[model samples]
Target: MNKVSLLSSSVRQQSLQAVALLVFLVMGLSGAMGPTLIPAIRVVFGLGLSSAMTVQWIPLVVSGLSSLILAQLLHRFGAKAMVLGGLGLMTVGCLQVRLAILAPFGLDARYGLMLLALAVIALGTSVIQVAANLLVVQLGHARTASARLTLAQSFNSLGVLVGVSLGTTFALGAKTTTAPTMALGIGQAFGWSGAINAAVLAAAAMVAAGAWGVSRTSQAGQAPIRAALGSGWALAGAGGIALYVGAEGSIGSILIPFLHQKSVLNLTLEQAGHYLGWFYWGGALAGRLAGTWLLHRGAPAKWLGMAALGAVIASALAALGSGPVAGYAALTIGLFNAIMFPVIFSITVERSAAPSAAVSGLLSTAIAGGAILSALVGWTGEHFGFAVCFLVPMLAYGLIALFAGFGALLPSVDKAPQDSRMTSSVGNLSERT
Candidate 1:
């Protein structure tokens, strides 16, 4: 290739990776929207709080199962197929939810269909996450893979921020209006459902475009699933990922409730809730941006260790202290959490003997810890106190610190030559297409 052709090819490669970032952004948006969607569902369906909570778990359990299944499937089909499949499923799922809500059906019927829609969405999310994580890693230089993924994840945080904002605006802020066909209050809360549908459709379209652009690209070779399952380091990395997600989820889940306590920040429920986006997720966004630079300059494993240690100290301060000190400590943990996932995933994939898809699948499956750990924190908070519940995440973060330290001792794999060959192969394929 000529100099200009080479430069253009590089640009095309990066642009293609941006598609994965967009998918991540949509994933983040969908995730943040779930909590906001629940209350709206409650109002629309006339369900109690306990019943509404089921909406949260359905996606988590489904996504975990989907990741495991798709991981195995990747051995037969390439990442391109998986990405396209995920996007199609998500689009269909979102459409289903929207249509179900609009249908003039009874509450029970609508609720059942809504649950099905969520399951489809979650399954699609799992497939996209597994494929995209591997795709971003394959598209970049092996040395800066962590930084690349972190940068892409920064957009994920941005998506969360935007999703939260939109959900609040359209869902919570929706005004009640009369509908000739339905009950008086039903039409008002349904606005959020419509908004969610529109957003999902837009995201799906973007992903479809991305999928088309990369259709000719090739995925990394698959290693034996048995080898991946048996590797101690991969298992440890998976455990660490689960722990990290659990810790982060536990903290975010309780932040508002904890802040409402008189002994803590004693903020009103509204004020405390607002801090979730401003401090918790905003800090996360900042951390990822900073982490991108840090990972480029320093060792990813060492940085992961230091960030986990920071989280441990912050969790301790939040647990042990009261007033603003505790509140700030609790929120700042998001900053430390920002880079751990990408760093852990990159390091784990590099060190593992299994193929990238297998390692990614194992790591992605570990995200179920969010549900598990959140339940633990809730149980602990109910029995003990919310402040004391910080102990759970503190313990989780401590373990992550140890995992990162151990990971630092392992040998790194150089996949640059393989990546370059893949890139050339992709270029040739693209030209033929």
Candidate 2:
């Protein structure tokens, strides 16, 4: 390529990267509301705690299952179309959610319609995630994508921070005694979500139309799902991502109530919401920024392992301690939770013998962990109480620490044999000097 052409290509790639990051940020914003606005949802629908928690877990199940087909969908539609379509879907889903909340239906009907709307939102989110992950890989080699993805995740955390503030201030801000006011607040929040999605959809479409030829090309010849199924890295990474997503989500989902307990912070709901946004999710944003810097330096596996261990300890403290100690402990887990997903994702992409798109698609399916583990966390909280609910994430984090260690033992790209299929630790260790 000529210098001008190369410069042009570079500029267009940069533009796409920005678009992908925006998608991740909005996805976080939209996703955070479900968990953070549970209080308002209960007030509107007259749900118990466990039932309100379904707003998060059930839709997460839909997203995870929908993601299983991402690679196939991408092969058929390409990244640009998927991104645009996903944004549109999210826009409509948000509107649907608002309408569902406003519907003058009986309790069972209202709950079911809202769940369906959230499922639409989840499906859209699933598509955006797969497309964004793939776009980053296409922009550069998958081997080097860890740091980039981590940087992008920082924006995702930023969105979470914003979402928490908005959900608490708007949705949960209404007086619980006034049903109409509470419903209006929820409607306003959903309106914001729908408007943002629409704006992003327009922006993405404009950029893609004016920019490069990258997303215009098709994913031909290879079946990512098939390739991912055969790869051990994909298998292990899938498990780790599932646990990591679930564990992180589990903690965020419960932070408000956990902090509100008199045994803990003894704070009001509003005060607890601040802690959730600033301390828990805010710590997450800061950690991702720090992790972005650290990942650029090296030793992502070691860093991943260390972070997971930190989360394990923090979660244990949250479960076993009381007063401010447990409050602080629960908050610190967000700090440790920061680097887990991007690091796990980048490592798997770098090491997997499977196609990168296939691996990414496969890993997306593991987001079902959010649904499965969230349900367990809620159930445990209902039956065994907060102590046991916190432990659910503790176990999940522990498994991720082990997964990080396992990845650590694997041969890195520089050290691996020419025969890439020989991935066993023993197989690689025997060949080492």
Q: lDDT of model 1 at residue 84?
A: 65
Please report the TM-score between candidate 2 and the true structure: 0.92
For model 2, how does the per-residue alpha-carbon lDDT over 160-246 read when each residue is reduced to its tens digit?
A: 888788778876665563667767777778789888888888888888886632222334534448878898878999999989888
User: What TM-score does structure 1 among the candidates reach?
Assistant: 0.82
Candidate 1, residues 1-433, lDDT tens digits: the string is 7999777666656556656777777677656655544445666777654465556656766776667677766645656567667766765665666667667888899888878877887787788888778767656567788998899889888877666555545544445412222222223223443354356446545544433333223443443557668888888988898888778756766676678788888875446656776788889999999999989999999999999999999999999999999999999999999999999998998888666667788888877756677667767776788888999999999999999999889987543343322333236322221
Q: Candidate 2, 283: how far from true, in Å?
A: 1.1
Off by over 4 Å in 1: 2-8, 36-57, 75-77, 91-115, 170-223, 414-433
What's the CA error at residue 326 for candidate 2, in Å?
Answer: 0.4
Q: Each candidate: how many clashes?
A: 0, 0
Instruction: State the displacement of the C-alpha of residue 128, model 2, in Å, after optimal TM-score superposition.
Output: 0.9
lDDT of 2: 0.78
